[model samples]
Target: MPAVRLSDVAQDAGVSLATASRVLNGSTRVPGKAVAEKVEASALKLGYVPNAQAQALARSRSGLIGLVVHDIVDPYFATIAREVQQQVFASQSQVLFTQTDREIDTEIRALRSLIAQQVDALVLVGSHRYGNDSDAALTALLEGFARNGGRVVGMGQSLGVGRTIVPDNAAAAHELATALIVGGHRRFAVVQGIAGIPSAGDRTGGFIAALTEAGIEPELSIEVGLTRDGGHVLAQQIQEHLAAAPDDPVGESLPLCVFAPADVMALGALGELRRLGIDVPGQVAVAGFGGVPDADDANPTLTTIALPLHEMARQAVDWVLEQPDEGSAIGPEGSEGGAAHEAADTSPEGSAEETPSEVHVRGDVLLRESTALAASD
Candidate 1:
């Protein structure tokens, strides 16, 4: 059978083709209530599907947003993706996603494809490696995209060219380290993630600066990929370092506190340590940044900086949608749109109305048992 078209719906509803097209293609010049209802009912009866290109042409809006992330399975990105979807849906649109595996070339290709699809806006998440120079190609693409009327939003980091939600990663890590030192932690080690990735680098740098300011130096430093498997490698390195050390006369040494710049890495190290029969907090203490959900569920509860990930996601959604004051949210039917949210810090004079405003939000340091957090809050 032939596919039902707009002309067919028009004939069936006794309306002109132009009127049917206007009604079905999302044109702003809508007809009167009765005629619109008739055309809609007729289109439904005839199973006429409107062409996406035609609808976009008529409305000048595609109602689609592009979301780019490194890995959807990563809990951190996963949380942001979920929130972006809900917020996009609430605005009566759809989300198109692409994962680039943290590869620059792959990211370029994925974004080009999204532009071809004519997404109305973009939400870019994950690391912003080696500013301007390395990102030149991606930046050009984004600038062109913006010129074509599509909005750009950067979540979790600053992307120089677009509106951004920046987290105070370095500051938070510095505070966490200071607190641990005040709690009498002396011997220290650092496990760093990918060198150029901004977030991990900031955390490691901040933690080290705090120790240096307190007149102490980390005894060991290891760099690895920002992954759980990397954390396992960290555990082996720790084991080797401890094995080569001298023990005190009483056959015991001060506990070594190790800091992994990410929660996933810390949890991985913690698990591997237990597997190696190492007693946590007795011989060694571990801490991590980014308070991922799994951190609290870890055996001894991982100490971390609880970042406002949900708030960051929402702010990105709001900027891309240009609806900071629009409070509705999409959820399961019968659920209210209003729910209490984690507080976010916005630039005092910046509003979503601004084209390229930057909002900065900070995380709270939660010292848990992984660092042998005391009962005091």
Candidate 2:
């Protein structure tokens, strides 16, 4: 059987094809209420399914928001995604989400796909790779998106196209470092994630800088993959190092502290430490960032700097859906109007554009059994 077309519905309802399209697409420009009701009834009776592409072209909006995240399975991303999903649905729109596994090329592809579909807005929930060739391409893509009237918002770092909600990783790590120092932890080891990643770098940098200012140096610092296995490997290496030099002053210290800037890595380290029969806070202490839900329920209760992920998600959704200001690049439809272009006045590629308006969220430092002071203190 031939597919039912918009004209068929219009004919069935005794209305013009334009009226049927306006009714089906829910356009604000529809003519009469009675015609709309008749058109709806005819579409239902005729089993008509509107072409999304055609409707988008006619109505100048897709009512779709695209979200790009790195590793949705990670609790950090999961927490924020949940809130973003809820807020987008509440606004009578749908979400198109994808995961990029922290790969810049993969992220760029995801952005391209979303832009191809002409998503009304975009929310990117991860750190931007800055000062690199890939960043320049990403910036160009975002600038084109902005020129076409699409709104963009970022969670971890600036994407140069729109507002960004950056957590103060450096500040939070410094705070955690100071707390550890005050808790009588003079010896330290750090299990750091891949270098150049903003979140990991900032946290590690801040902690080291603070400790250095206090006249203490880390006993060991190991670079590892940003994964559980990385943390597990670091734990084993720490044990080996201690075994090889049992009487070394740093190795002899009670409650030797180890900081992993991500909770997943910390949990992995904790598991390995327990398997080795090490007494946490008695022999070694573990601390982490990202107050994922599982942290509070862990055996020793993770000490961490809890990022305001849910709140950040809420603000991101709200900001992306906000109406474009007059004379702003965004068009009436809120998307880039189906073409890729760059605004002349958009900030330099790969650099943040100073928008007077932005949403800022803070992190909280939580002390727990995993990082408690030694008995002497």
Best by TM-score: 1
> In angstroms, how far off is 323's CA in candidate 1?
5.8
Give the alpha carbon lDDT tens digit for every residue of 189-278 in model 1.
Answer: 997657558888888889999999999889889987677887899988989888998452223356789999878789889999999888
Inter-residue clash pairs, candidate 2:
148-336
Tell me how far the alpha carbon of residue 44 in candidate 2 is from the true structure, in angstroms, after superposition: 4.1
Candidates' C-alpha lDDT = 0.78, 0.78
Instruction: Give lDDT for model 1.
Output: 0.78
lDDT of 2 by residue, 61-174 (tens): 687898998887777888889899999999877899999988889989999988887787788887877457898899888766765666678888656666678888888999
Report lDDT (Cα) of residue 60, candidate 2: 63
lDDT, candidate 1, residue 301? Answer: 89
Candidate 1 lDDT at 66 equals 89
Per-residue lDDT value at 290 in model 1? 74
